[model samples]
Target: MEGALERSLRVFSGRGVLRTEYWDATIERFHLVSVPPDTAYQIGYTGTEPLWIGAWSSVGGDEITDESTLEPAARPEGNAEFDRIMATRSDRDLATSPGYDGEYDADPDEDRPEPVVTSFANTAAKLCPKAPEVGCNADRLAWIAELPELEWFSDSTVMKLDPGMYASTHTHFENEGPHEEIYWVMAGKARLITEYRDARLRRFDCAFFPTGNPHGIGNVGTETLWIGAWGARGGIEGDFDIANLDVADRPGQIEEYERVMAARKQRGLPLPPNADILDP
Candidate 1:
């Protein structure tokens, strides 16, 4: 059997779409997603705080050949906090174990950057509960990437929507008709509805929303729905940025939410508490 580390390196080239699950020195709980075409990967992770993120991109959509001098290391260079965290890594961190055999070192010359933890725990922990508070329709949410650390994408994050919370029907930047986005149900179940389509998203099921589309997601399962969301090379992407959302046309969504609340009321169920704020 091929070792997990070797197998990951074998297919982790900067060409095409590559997906693998890794339990390295810096990663704890993890989930990744992305869009297609040029290639993208969104990862949700918890680990030592990192100072920079590394990723690969082709110079002109061809093979990644550029000044990307990033070498492959279990964690970013010069992160003492990360080193401390890894020292106490759980037994589940198999790749870092002494007996594991999978390993790959980047060719000293190619030095292509690879996909990183698109999401970070330190920042994720600081995000407001309402991912897009203004236009969203949900009352309760457990989201992970309000402000992710990446180069090509923005407003990308993951959320675990409990039964009572929902993603309000809205578009990216509202009237700004074009946005590319990805939503994947990593675990549990969810019901996603877009301007033109709606379906139940089960484990590993994903829905892609191209530009100029509207969509929303909510948990329809008994357990919390773990969702992985991402976007590609567009939108408001900066070191610490969140997209500007417009709520002018959100009354319709509010009306729809009222209906759900009414149903909860009819069944003698209280609406989930709506108070969520970033701490001061």
Candidate 2:
């Protein structure tokens, strides 16, 4: 992932479109949109695609409209206090456990118990410095920073897969309600393998995962993969994991999953049910 300084530099360099946009509730800091020259100006390459790239501020909900006009904003003065709070919640302590396996050596009809605490809104708020009122983990992922209050919010625990650790077979439960998500790669490389398409994902690459689709991620390289995931809530309860069931064993279920994957591929979106690895 690019450092804070590098990201700031890139924003001012005009390498891409840089603007702040309003999202659900908060104002995103740096939103980059890609622009290209006319077809006649082509030197050698001949491709017409708008490449969108950029980052945003996770704090203060401030938007950077004009990069050229942006002055160096002073850092929060209370360094000691901020350091103390950050030290208490390093990356290791908040790491997520591996996802549940889909193999059913046991009974398939077994019912799992509902968690006493289904929502993390309160917990996340306490941990986050921006919106202390909401309990979502501000430090849940590697790339996101803290943010202040917002009318709407969504969050989830994510794990980046290390290449050469596992195969590409997995399953994610479909939510009963409407929801949408984006999978943004922070570091390394990955390949999203679904019933329909197999696409490569790299640093700064992003893929969208729509509701009701079941898919998984595979590390396509030897390095550790880091990803940032943002999505809306559907209030569903089901585990996302790798399943051993083959298409021959469950043709109907596999067919439905494939349809979703194919649709997303047509629109150049990521596969649903993004990668979830279990820790041994």
Candidate 2 per-residue lDDT, tens place, 151-255, comes to 112332234456533222323335222444466666677775555666777877777666655555556676876655554333332233112222223334445
TM, every model: 0.47, 0.34
- Model 2, C-alpha of 124: deviation from truth (Å): 10
lDDT of each: 0.42, 0.35
Instruction: Put down candidate 1 lDDT per residue, 7-31, tens digits, no spaces.
Output: 0111111222222222232333332
Alpha-carbon deviation at 10 in model 1, angstroms:
19
lDDT of 2: 0.35
Clashes counted in candidate 2 amount to: 12
Each prediction's total of clashing residue pairs, residues at least 3 apart in sequence or on different chains, is 3, 12
List candidate 1 stretches off by more than 4 Å. Answer: 1-24, 31-115, 118-120, 125-137, 142-151, 173-178, 233-280
Per-residue error at 51 for model 1, in Å?
Answer: 25
